[model samples]
Target: MPTFKKNQSSTPKINKDNLNMAADAFKESLVNIRNSKTLHYIQRQRKKISENRSASEKYTEFVKKGQDKPRLRDADAPKTLQERGSETVNRFVKYVKHHRKPRDERAVRHINPKHLLWVLGGICLVLIILSGVNERFRAPFRDAASIVVVPIQKGINSIGLWLSDRIEAGKTLAQLEEDNKKLKEQVENLTMTVTSLRQKELELNRLQELFQISEQYTEYDMVAAHVIAKDSNKWFSTFTIDKGTNQGILKDMNVIASGGLVGIVIDAGPNYSTVRSIIDDESYVSSQFEDTSELCMLKGSLTLMEQNLLEFTDVSADVMISLNSALITSHVSSTYLPGILIGYVVDYQLDANDLTQSGHIKPVVDFADLQEVLIITKLKETSD
Candidate 1:
């Protein structure tokens, strides 16, 4: 609501009394207008004159306030409120046209903030690239990584190399150890074989020495002969030697044992010879007592004695003989030495040609164990 402000310059109570008087006068004038037509005409003409004067006064007031003059002919345009508001709206539009609004609050075009940001970033990147061409401006991220991550990478690389080297070394060590084990086993086996070979060499040396001592009898012309064959049925009675008539060995040659006479060479060939032991039939050797001068003859009698024994026949039956008396060759032996050692007489006999009792005579020479021998070469020729 618009409050009407009093115009202080106006007369207060007098103006009010004058207004009442004018109103009363206007009422009288209206009554007169109602009473007579000529009076009414006269009153209307005065009222018209008063309205023209009021119009003139209002037009003068608009002119004094710098407002457009109200034309009575155009009064119908200000009838509606929209029409009445047009003059004020037109005046405001004209003021805006002459004086522009502040530029800060004004719209320019349709804006895309994201696209603007991209354009601005592109410009900054171009500037940065141009600056990087100087070879001085580096990426900040690269500098930071060099400060924090380079040492770690180097450590990882070193650890990988170390582990790889260790693995290779371990494999090499294992292979070497295995090779060493094999070499050790080979060396041990070789050492054992060497020891066994040395022992065999010692045994062969002993056999050679024995062979040398057995060869000392050069007078009899003893020859080295290997035992080639053995008679299985007459194991202790016969055996074959590799030496024969071709080697100066003959039939009935004396075959001496390691200590004394053992048998006689009987069968002879070009390259082989057979020996009949004293324990066999048809074998004989003249023997004498070692302690006395009594003479005897060795005879083979398998029926009278057991295996590996012989007999001294035709002795005096009452004569005594020792159990281990040494017996040897007598001077009466024409084919053998007169005093070459034969063996000990274990049992014997003495006789007066037919009354002598005979028993077994264990020979000192073990005929079955003879490996080598000496053949006597000096003997009487066969008498014609």
Candidate 2:
């Protein structure tokens, strides 16, 4: 109890955990040392020493370490480290460039912007005064400047002129297009007006002809009517008129145009009537020569009508009828009024019996283009 012996068996055993804790403590001590100002200063002094070494010394040291060959040195032969470092530092200082200190921001802030502007204005005024006072002083510079700038100015001017011309051309094209449109409109309007006027003129002339026919037949009560419809193949054969019994038109009423007899009203309705023209194959008229009073029966044929002719027969051989003699409807006719124009004699020949004659007559009416006609209200058989 008086002497205490070391307790070896009580000593703790070292494991991976204890070793790890000791390594952590060592890493923390290293971090503390790296962050200390004394370590920072030592690192800076080492960097300075390395920078002060001559390139020749660095190359020699690299060669001593069994590295690659070094570049040749252009300085004096190798010297001590202190002498070489001093020489290297002195060379660096000889090439070192000293720069002026930057202007203090506080001093710059004290300067007024207006004072700088005034100074610049004074310089510009002096230049202007000098230029005015001595033309020769600026002439050389002006000429030199023009030598370089004249071509550029000319190019700019030409570009401007080209652009202006293009603009004007575009405007002119637009104007021309607008004018062309207006001209087209005017031409169309004129064409329409001309067509309308021509139609009215034709109508007026037709009415005038009808009026003259009415005057010629003063004793007959006549009604003017226009042809409404006809068969295209039989233009002069049969047609409908725009008048009927409502306007006093009756069957067998004589229809006449400007020239002479046209047809007889074969059918009548309340508003329209149908007429069988003298050119129809079924038409037969008692016709007599105006000069000789010779009576003949006129018959229609499609072939004869194509030649503007009608067949005439039953004329007595004693009756003297010559070519171009006018023929009219005879008083013996039941459907046609007396003295109505029928046709003119064309060809004549004696019949096989030798007692009568037959011939062809050219009708007075132009049956192809009949537009309007007059219907005689009085029936040939019923009229007093």
lDDT values, one for every candidate = 0.67, 0.76
TM-score, per-candidate, Cα-based: 0.39, 0.43
What TM-score quantifies how close candidate 1 is to the native fold? 0.39
Please give, for residues 217-266, the per-residue lDDT of candidate 2 as tens digits: 34688899877667678535898776766688887899998859998998
Tens digits of per-residue lDDT, candidate 1, 40-72, equal 566556665555444335445545665665676
* Model 1 weakest lDDT span, ten residues long: 134-143
RMSD of each: 56.9, 41.5
Question: How displaced is residue 273 in candidate 2, in Å?
Answer: 0.5
Model 1 score (lDDT): 0.67
Error of 1 at 333 (Å): 2.4
Best by lDDT: 2
Number of backbone collisions per candidate = 6, 0
